[model samples]
Target: MGKKEKSYALGVDVGGSHITVGVVDLVSRTIDQKRLERHPVDSKGSLTEILEAWAGAIEPFCQHEVLSTVQIGIAMPGPFDYDAGISFIDSTQDKYESLYRKNVKDLLAKKLGVSNAQVRFKNDAACFLQGEVFAGIAKGYKRAIGMTLGTGAGTAYYHGTEAHDAARWGEEYGDSIAEEYFSTRWFAKKYQEATGKELSGVRELVDMKEESWVQAIFKEFGQNLGKFLVKFASEENAEIIVLGGSIAHSSALFLPETEQVLSRSLPGVPIKKSILGEESALIGAASCWYEA
Candidate 1:
């Protein structure tokens, strides 16, 4: 009898300033935390430079001569065509300017010496929820909402069996998006507006949770987040909401108020923090193929 072939998938998480890749075991739907490869990318650099850096980060996981039947799934940020694999981010963003209107799938496949068909792209936010639905907190939930609270509010909804992008819903907020009030930038901005002290990010503000002003800031943030959720929960019919990303790490600072608000308004829906942490994206990226 022929030897049973091993199945694996290369999952890549491409962020604004970094790229992380992993080799996920198909059957297990998980990646080795130790074997995961991460590298910083200069989004402001030339497209060739960024692509090369992404390829380089992934190469370490593909060192073996052959990865028979291995598939590639990339959790990519949007404002682009996911099906066409094109990037729409422009110079105005101060990042990925060189890749504006570029066919990312083909170019990335070429850089990695893989057939274009072997690569698939999905919104990073959807992948985040997908990862959670596959093996994290939402594993058994029939429906759920997921958000990444970082530079922006990356949102997704999982229904039936797949995660779908719900980021567009953020547009309802204002000229910018819901992210304007739901992200770390919002936290920083609110903090500075009140204290007149500039902060690099939410971590600094979280560290000062002991201060009454900081506590009030987070409480208000939680209330804002809860209000946002109330608007979407009914439309999404989500049974639970899970939060990930840099800001979510400080859930203790804000979750109490968030839960209180939800309990009063939305009621039954549960709000939880991501259990998989960083690995969720990698696993979720790989799940793109697994679920297909």
Candidate 2:
């Protein structure tokens, strides 16, 4: 027999200022890195501009005969109506303001010359976790919690079969919500308060790791994260915790402290840094169609 035909799906990861698209192999549950594409998006741009950027990124794969009818799965940030394919991101978020209440699925479909039914959306946080559970670090675990730590924080819970957004970014923690304490903003804010100097984000802090103050900051952040995870993991009874995002790239700086805190209360629970990185969302998003 001729080599068996392989199936593929288009997976897109929509971020605050950029979009990443890749072809995911349905059988292997992996992204074809050679076909991956990333494009900048002006989130503040007009609706037409944003839609064009997204469609442009996805159009290439559609040109191939085998992928002409490929299903498209998008990992988008919330507050979005995933089921209805409408965007609810408004001015309050500083990004995608023009997309407020827009039907992104229909618009993008029209741009790509595809039917709306060919596109689907899922929460970015949930996609991150789903990707991990589906093919990465949390693969064997029956229950897992995944977090993405960056400009903001994202959380999701996996219940064996699938994952869903945990929507805990706004959860009360200390004097503020969980996002304030668990994100890159927290590191910048804490650093500025201590040294009376401005720092960009976690990357800068990583370079300054030898500084006692920086080390102290990472430890404090880790402890705070551990405390927060204790409650989140306990509530969900998560068997494992997987972390991804820009901040997670610097796990070495804070993971020890995080592990220490968790050891005291949630001992034996494993915390893993994402092995797939950006591709996690891509694979997860594509899996939507495969799983369905």
Candidate 3:
């Protein structure tokens, strides 16, 4: 008799603000019991505690008997030594000690008892873009760029499931091309300075009830987003650009302005909002394991 096909594997996404965990069934082409768990970055929690939260949130799915392999994918913030699967850089969460070292991948795999399993780690933006391609707005498009407009902006290029050996990916050094001066955080900073309102995140800044109040912020964001896309278009010559983030989801607030600006600057290349919400990373992580 032929060997039975493996069941499902779990995919986990760890962002600066939250974590998402899901189970993906390959043959069925469906996601099961996807969960979004929020965890803030803090100068607290030991390495074990942090990981326990990550593992524990996703553990329920692994208990399913049909899963042949416990595949785990992590979409982390930047500057990781992906080849070594290590996050050498420390997060703001460093208390008296840092959480991880050279063997984070090893540690995670061991803790999960996934010694023989596949564990992949890459920039969160790349995973976000991958999610865009897998289930978000960029599906079927071979060449595309995905920009995550969040606390900091991040961009990654992908040609379908494969990334074209990125010459530059998002990093703190300036967010490089992702540094759209008009990001929501940028707007909050400028709005707070210009309007004198202490706002939480950009979400409050773009409440949309007051269009005129937010017009300048949206306009500036459009200009910057447009300019950056033009540069990317010149380089990657991509056909589409996808955006995924909380800020991106509020397309009602700023996307029209963004579209108008890109239309003027980027002629043929099109810009689109992310269909996959915050769950994009979770979906992307699941795609990673399901594809392999």
The model with the greatest lDDT is 2
lDDT of 2 by residue, 1-292 (tens): 1244336788899999999999898778888878999999999999999998998888988887444466888999999999899999989889998999999899988899888988999999999998888779988899999999998899999987878999999999999999999987898799889988887778988998999988999999999999999899999999999999999988999999999989999998989999999999988998887743
lDDT of each: 0.83, 0.90, 0.65
List model 1 lDDT by residue over 68-139, tens digit each: 345888998878788889999887667788899999999988888877877889988998988888879888
Which candidate model has the greater TM-score, 2 or 3? 2
Q: Which digits, one per residue and each the tens of the lDDT, describe model 3 over residues 1-292?
A: 1244454556677765456777665555456653444555432566777677666765665666433456667777655766577765565433313444656677766766666346777677787777777766787888898777776667788865554224343423235334536355576767788768876777776665477767777766766667666777668878898887767766666677667767786778788887776766766666665543
TM-score of each: 0.93, 0.96, 0.84
Q: Order the candidate numbers by TM-score, best to worst.
A: 2, 1, 3
Clashes within 3 Å, all models in order: 0, 0, 0
lDDT of 2 at 39: 95
Q: What residue pairs are clashing in model 1?
A: none
Instruction: Give the clashing residue pairs of candidate 2, or none.
Output: none
In model 3, what lDDT does residue 260 have? 75
Q: Candidate 1: where are CA atoms >4 Å away? A: 1-6, 65-68, 174-176
Among all windows of 10 consecutive residues in model 3, the one with the lowest summed lDDT is: 164-173
* Candidate 2 runs further than 4 Å off: 1-6, 66-68
Give per-residue lDDT, candidate 3, residue 65.
41
